[model samples]
Target: MEINGVEIKDTYAEGFGIKVTRILVTAATEELAKIAATEATGYGTSVIGCPAEAGIDCFVPAEHTPDGRPGYAIMICQGGKKALDHELMERIGMCVLTAPTTAAFNLLESEDTLKTGNKLKFFGDGFEKECFIDGRKVHSIPIMSGDFLVESEFGYKDGVAGGNFFILAKDQMTGVKAAQAAVEAISKIESVITPFPGGMVASGSKVGSNKYSKFLNASTNEKMCVTLKDEVESDIRADADGVFEIVIDGVDEESVRSAMKSGIEAACAVDGVLEISAGNFDGKLGAYIINLHELF
Candidate 1:
């Protein structure tokens, strides 16, 4: 398949099921809200070295926020319930709660469960109080600047993780430009995040190890590397001289597919972009293999 002169591989992207939690961060100003939300979602690219994958979900204007200030919604995904809870406590407490004039709230609601506010209340050091509104519990933690309010419990749902695509270009600048275009395209879509470094990972991995005895999680796709183009399989090799990968995580297969399709379309419109591709295992994650052609 060709999109605006760029080749689109007829392959699929594989992903797995993960638990996701959304939190709302409000602040006195829009800049503060952006800072708090970005900080809370920082360092959460991939689950390999990080506990979860997170990013700014959306921005809400003052009229939509409780404090009449700008706010942002953030989503964090973990492998399981335990990891999700732990990450939520640490990130929200240390990042959002500590930020100036910022407050946290649960974007999700549950009937009977362990609430995030209940875990974060300890940060108040005994000055914390709880309030019930519309049957939802909110914790008020006294801070130096003001009070930080957070919801007691957050709702968790199964989400799709690791939907990805590759942008092959003739040079680093071209690759970067293509990736930027793709990011901009995907950014407009809801419920998806490009969680790699700077929302794009230059170095992508394969399924398993080819060498290195002690390396249990080493999988290198030499074909995707320009320097190793002569040393790997031709099918996976990039026709261009440079390559970059965009990894997306979303609420479901359709959301991911939509994001990927939009991103690829945007990237392919740029110059020096030769082909668009995806990363996947051989049916290992059969539950969420989004076909590229079907998406386009």
Candidate 2:
């Protein structure tokens, strides 16, 4: 349970079953790949808050990319077919389609027919063109820099969503540093991504509301805030003064557990890190149960 001097909790992180699609964005260079990846994953934190939960999954070296440029893989998570389709349409249309010298492709190779590029083709205002590459249909949308290519549709598979961990530290700097280290670790792992803001969310939420409106499904956990430590149920360690949550989405429970284990190990190496814990709804989410201790 001890990673260096930091304590890893014996608790588990729970995740529910959701449909996931992998999006490959390729650019002319690493800088463009990073920018496109950031944009594609931007504005995507929570399903209710944003349209989907997405992040950069990995980077492909130039030799591996289609255009012989650096590329990034991103995972988009949604609850169902309709949500996934709709969100992908919006995100691809707005983010990937707008980026310069970039192309999008479906990570999944499936026979099931879907229409991702068919929906986004509207952005071309009828001037769009299509091509077949390796038997996959790709659409090209004219932009300022050049044409942006995207696959017709991405493959859909059931995946684990909402795998998360909290990094409690003695201060904001420590917490942020820990988070950065964790992101670096997670980025190296395949099939997992941190979708929250800056790969971390400070405002952790709990199930249901206390005094809020009936329509609200969840609200912020004020108790987790350092300022409210005196008035709320304190779960943070005594030496910890700040907290940040890392929310991960993965293709499966095992992938999530591996990513979490790697992330926690990297995060605990930093100074001022007190403990590593996870967010869960007990066993409500039956599909993915990531036991932190077992994972590490």
TM-scores, one per candidate: 0.93, 0.91
Every candidate's lDDT: 0.82, 0.83
Q: What lDDT does candidate 2 reach at residue 258?
A: 85
- Per-residue lDDT for 50-135 in model 2, tens only? 87888889888878765567899888888888888887887778787777788887876655435988878778888899888657
Write candidate 1's Cα lDDT for 116-235 as tens digits: 788888888999999974455788899898888888888877888989988888888899999999998988887788887667888787765778647646466776778877776744
Error of 2 at 35 (Å): 2.5
Count of steric clashes across candidates, in order: 0, 0
The regions of model 2 sitting more than 4 angstroms off are 111-113, 122-128, 141-145
Which candidate ranks first by lDDT, i.e. highest? 2
After the best TM-score superposition of candidate 2, give how far the Cα of residue 251 lies from its true spot, in angstroms. Answer: 1.4
